[model samples]
Target chain A: MTEAAGTAGPAGSAGAAGVDGPGRPGPRRGRVLEGLRAYGLIAAMWIRSTMAYRTSFVLMTVANFAMTVLDFVAILLMFSQVDALGGWSLAEVAFLYGVSGVSFGLADLAVGSMERLGRRVRDGTLDTLLVRPVPVLAQMAADRFALRRLGRVTQGVLVLVYALVLLDVDWTVAKVLLMPVMLLSGAGIFCAVFVAAAAFQFVAQDASEVANAFTYGGTTMLQYPPTVFAQDLVRGATFVVPLAFVNWLPAGYVLDRPFPLALPEWVAFTPPLVAVACCALAGLAWRAGLRSYRSTGS
Target chain B: MTDGDGAAAGGAAFIELDGVEKVFDVRRKTGFLKRERREVRAVDGLSFTVARGEMVGYIGPNGAGKSTTIKMLTGILTPSGGRLRVAGIDPSRERTRLAHRIGVVFGQRTTLWWDLPLIDSYRLMHRMYRIPDARYRENLDRCVELLQLAELLEVPVRQLSLGQRMRGDIAAALLHDPDVLYLDEPTIGLDVVSKAKVRGFLRDVNAERGTTVLLTTHDLQDIEQLCSRVMVIDHGRLMYDGPLAGLHEVGESERTLVVDLERELPPVEAPAPARVVRVEGPRQWLAFPASASAAGLVAAIAARYPLVDLSVREPDIEAVIAKMYAERASA
Candidate 1:
């Protein structure tokens, strides 16, 4: 494609301007379009390949749909064990679970490729992507989307909406907008964990499943008020590791409850900020892993 | 003019490699936790060139830097020290750009999408090279027809037999219609019929499209059938780089003669005109010196004993190459 651009220019003024002649105004635009070509290619392959196993695809989707109902089962089982162990009401805990369900499911749907990244690297499959003109991250991003994750996302949104109704707070446009931001923030946190796990695979050859502590454990921590957990361990994970951004701080902002850790209402924005930082770090770390792979030929 | 000026005098060579070397430090295992490190030179001080449309057969024993050199040429591995160019394009600096201009086929690897049908991979490659849609269709049709892959277009890659898979792979490489095609053992593991088909297709791709092809195959027939020039590498060094014909005529020990005799040889041997290679039932293998005539050897054998049949055979590539390597080693 770059070569074609070289030819696209005329002999008369070829060296003067790096432009592909005036007749074709889209030459520069074409270069940008080419990078996206690999993404489209992988997505199309993923769709066709996944659809081939029809029964398994449907079963997985159904299992995920059923998986959401387990949240209600947990709450009901817990309520029977005790009226309320923590000071918070059951409805507030349900609200936290709902927001987490929405964000985590969306993260799985959008960035699931990071989970299989170790296997791709081991098999030399990613080598093909490297040889192509596009950046490797873009190609990885384009591969595999789990539409079935809609079950969890939907369940989470429903519980969040119910919690909002029960609380009966005077909601404004800004407050309503904060919900989506937190949801996206939750996604960023999970994706960062995946990226970090994938990056570690370069050194270990196997993905660091410990990263799941931040993702799955982070989700669990989000389902309850942060005050219930001891300040040393859970508090440290929330403050230092920032799982609180996913639910605790954001929940405090939304529920109008006093947060165990002192912070401003601006804490609702923690999810997006931390998520972005994690993503950028993950991207840089992924690139560092790629360089290591090339040097080592592993 | 000096060598540099001389090259400039004749218009720069299509491809050039100057003293390329690659040394890798590998961790060698010692007892248990005590592992020693060693630096293994994969390629060293190698240099060669290919003019436009030249099909050079690169051959070497296993682990003798053949792969390392090819990787350097293809821009996969950066040579520790060298100046290299392919069609005036620096492969390493412009690796991604070079991808569009060249096609690569590793017999052990497949570039096609694993799960997608053959056509889908081709379509994806079409977008990759940005071959205009009409040109993509034209090239796709030509490659498909040439490779006899029209019937197999919808078939997934995993289902194709080794022969069929190789053919599909070659077609995939050409789908982008690259200027240079790097074929690393393109016909390995193929049956006689499939091997012939692959060789025929490659010859045509070179001749018809004027596409420069660099093929590395263990099958010497691949060389004799396709390449005009052969480059032999041994121990990370260029042993020989010239016409295939020149290799056979090394050092005047040329030609072999066979005499079929009806009667057995006498217990006491007579002075022979040529050295005998072997003597089997009704067959006498004789090596004729380049200085001597085959008829002289045959007539002398006939005078000494009754001969049923007589014929002369040009030394095969195996004998020539083996002899070449052996002689180069001792030298």
Candidate 2:
């Protein structure tokens, strides 16, 4: 049988004409575009799947929207008792809250499902993703994407609009351009944190709570003025986790407020740089985690 | 042998492993703050070469490294030492590239989306693999026709029976016309009819497309019907590699002969090397080497006893493998 198979190799090769050999690495831009296309395809399928249950989808979206609204209502009640919080007025605090909310919301919508990496690894689903032709990161990030996450983004935009109508600050061309930059860089930083924290699941399969402390906890802490926290906590947020880059420093410049810790004005322009560095570090962590992966027994 | 010799021999060796090894570190908590770390050699110094267009059966007992070998071939788990290659590409280094040329199906799990219809997963794969629209449609139509998936195409994967889901998974793996297919327990937990259908479809696929298949199965019938060459592994090492007929000779296996007499009588007086191993009332069973002819033994028993009915049973592959393992251990 082995001899017959060896003799039929040429005929087999002819039948497999449609199959390609090991593919050469394509150009960087082409690969990036291909990854994006694949991500879009997978995410669209998830959205359609979620939309299949109309009442459930609508109820979940409304519930999510209502829950986030009450979070802001707590701040309203706080202002009824006091004039300002940590030397920032109601509108300034609202601005901070809005920026952090929108940034975290966008990040969650994109890669929040990554928190289930521990479960995937334990259940052997990661092996399925590794065999696909697409990038594993893209496949994981787009898995089970829920469109209801847009609820939080809509609420954040509303609050930001209300704050813009109330606060009176001298707006400039740079500030106008900086608004979109801050939101995008903020989202980038949050996405990096989500991926980096999830990467630790490869080593400790049940350590999802440690990731939640950094992601959801960090967003909640960022909603208030940085001055309200301790000096050491603020320093750690600034240097170690870089959560301050999400909105605090950039919003300070936009609001023309004094820097917390007496920092220079140039610090506000560094959010983009900080976001890039954080994402690079997170990419490294993800790669290392993939290398160390010990798949479950079959 | 060196890779130079392998490559110089021919390109027929599509999948080659030269002393491939995979060792896992397992840490167990023995006491309070005292742990013991140990190395588990799941696949130790395994080597084999599978030629293209060969449908080979890889069978072994549990924890014998069958799944581990398939995982290494697909690049899901990298080997710790030695060399491995498929289509002249290192699986670990160029997994994504190699993925385009190989297809895999795990019967224990489904790659299809749980909430989506069967066709939806195939459509997602169409775009994910960037397969040409014409080729994708052709392959999907062929698989659906052969596997009888037309009635189940619109049903959500979660609602399908185990048999239906297995067929769905097999179709998903082949939509891209991959050069090689790795199936780990494809017909496990399946009914008799489902197993036959799957086997028939696989035979058609191999004969028509000439797709190379490496199957890991606990079901010996899956081997007898599909594969011509079989490799037996035990304790992370290859113990036997030859034709299925040769495995019986190596294990010194035996076939059973049952003889039913006219009435309750003593054990049948069988010939030498074919003694009655068991007797109940008028029925007696004689054991002989599987390689020997059962016709002469039947004649001898008929000549001595008043036989009413008689039958012969072939040796099962599991018993052959067990005997092989026991012989190695005792030696």
Candidate 3:
């Protein structure tokens, strides 16, 4: 698609379109819609770019699925040796594992690029995002959109569906409806943690591996019932990082299991609220990080 | 130029800075037990105004804070103190708002996605910037034809040559039709042909679009070919700001005259202002003030010796800068 642009000699000739009296500020579209469109376009471009190497992408996806399945295999092997661990049956723990796995995989799909913020900061490439006309957060999310994460998410959802069909619990309508909310809000919570981790890079000026302890480690911990953990460790995950709000508590409510640590039943429903608060706090930390970035650009 | 109005009084300033200062507090560990904190002033009291439609060159040695100033202008780094306004908007405070009006290219790094095809990056920009479809197409078509990038559009950025990637980056920056373009060392690692192509493209962009440009490059030829105004900074201070011609005079630079004599002889006795600095075989080299008229020296040498052929050489900017730095240090 080509049109003869003014093609005026190598000197200033005001082009009619694009250039005019005072730039016209390019049509002020609705901010949310603009962000969404830009994000979608970025993700599409990333997918296309990945698809360029179709075989590699496919292999990586398959490998991710296989690797995640091994986790379930290990759990199954352990369950074979014993009927139950910490009073929860193997099938019940699989539900917990599936929910946390899906939530984490989904969040990784959205915000995994935050994990590389340290490298971008160290190399000064983050400046490219800063110069663009979009929010840095949206740009960061778009910068690294991995389709391979879907493999793990698919594995997780499959495990979850299988667990649901086989479990003897009476499936309530509320349980069915809240399952999706749990997954989405759980993803939101993980995404918030990722953003908060990115904020740490501004101070460290390098990739902070510490964030993985919560993001990946929290998901691993949630794969088992909190009752299996030491009291202090369970409390920390529940109250300190609120990892329990992501899946364990919600899964407990759905499975009709008693809450660990003497928590009320309402806490299970607070994933959405907790997720929102976490997002707000992450946003504040992200802003503070940006401020520090602008001040001390290292 | 079509931008004669911008040069006149009462014209709107496209970029303005007043006493801008950026001080970095660096903490270094002296040992396991002790550390030291010191404030390194990167840019101190930097003040300049760029008029609309002006293509200006910003030059400085390493660590002279050229990149820091560019960062501040782009709002990537905020100044420690002072006020800065680009198109009447404070850059750091209204960075996202200002982003729509400005385009930046960092020659050392790319803004393009690494794995995407060259055209894919441009396509992403079309949406990211919300560029009108018609405008995006027109700009892309122009850049492709002018940059000779049609064959490279489908190539992944990682596979592209540095020069090709640089051209792609320039095209990406312009697709949005930004009002101002900041190019930091745009020709840093490019070959001669690529440099010429880039310089010509920049000249066209500046002239046709009236995009106010502030170019920072180590390549003096980039400034010589494209910029009418040059600003030189040293030690976070404006050492010189004027025409490229005036830089040699400020640096107290000396031009060399290479004369081919018919035969090897003793050092040729030239006039008072010009003296033979080197003699080898039939070639005699003389040093003269860069500001002095070379015509008289040529005539004087021609009369004194059997001059086979003679060529006047402008002082290379590298030597000019070295001399300037030496003088600045001694002062």
Q: Write the per-residue lDDT of candidate 1 for residues B1-331, one digit (tens) a residue.
A: 1121112312346668888888887887898898899878787788887877778898878888887777767666556777877755555544555566678888878877666688888877776566789888888898788789889999887788899889998988887777788899998999998999898899999998878888887888899899999988888899888887777666344677877778767321324646777877677777766556676666666797877887898667666777877888798
Residue ranges of candidate 2 with Cα displaced over 4 Å: A1-26, A294-298, B1-10, B261-263, B280-283
Q: Each candidate's fnat, in order?
A: 0.17, 0.35, 0.50
TM per candidate, chain B: 0.86, 0.94, 0.94
Interface RMSD list for the candidates: 9.0, 10.6, 11.1
RMSD of 1: 5.9
User: What TM-scores do the predictions have?
Assistant: 0.82, 0.92, 0.92
Query: What are the per-residue Cα lDDT tens digits for candidate 1 across A221-284?
Result: 7787777788786667665666677777777777788866667777676677788887777866
lDDT of 2 by residue, A12-82 (tens): 22223223233322333444565678789999999888876889999999999999999999999999999
Q: What is the interface RMSD of candidate 2, in Å?
A: 10.6
Higher-ranked by lDDT: 1 or 3: 3
Residues A1-298 of candidate 3: C-alpha lDDT, one tens digit per residue: 0101111111112122222222234232333345556678888888887898899999999999999999889999998899988999988998998999999999998888788888888888898888876667777777768899899899999989878877987778988888999999999999998989888888885556788888888899999988889999989887788888888899999999999898999888899999999988887788788788888878
Model 3's TM-score against the true structure: 0.92
**Model 2 misses residue A174 by how many Å?**
1.8
Cα displacement (Å) at residue B265, model 1: 5.9
How many clashes in each candidate? 0, 0, 2
Ranked by lDDT, top first: 2, 3, 1
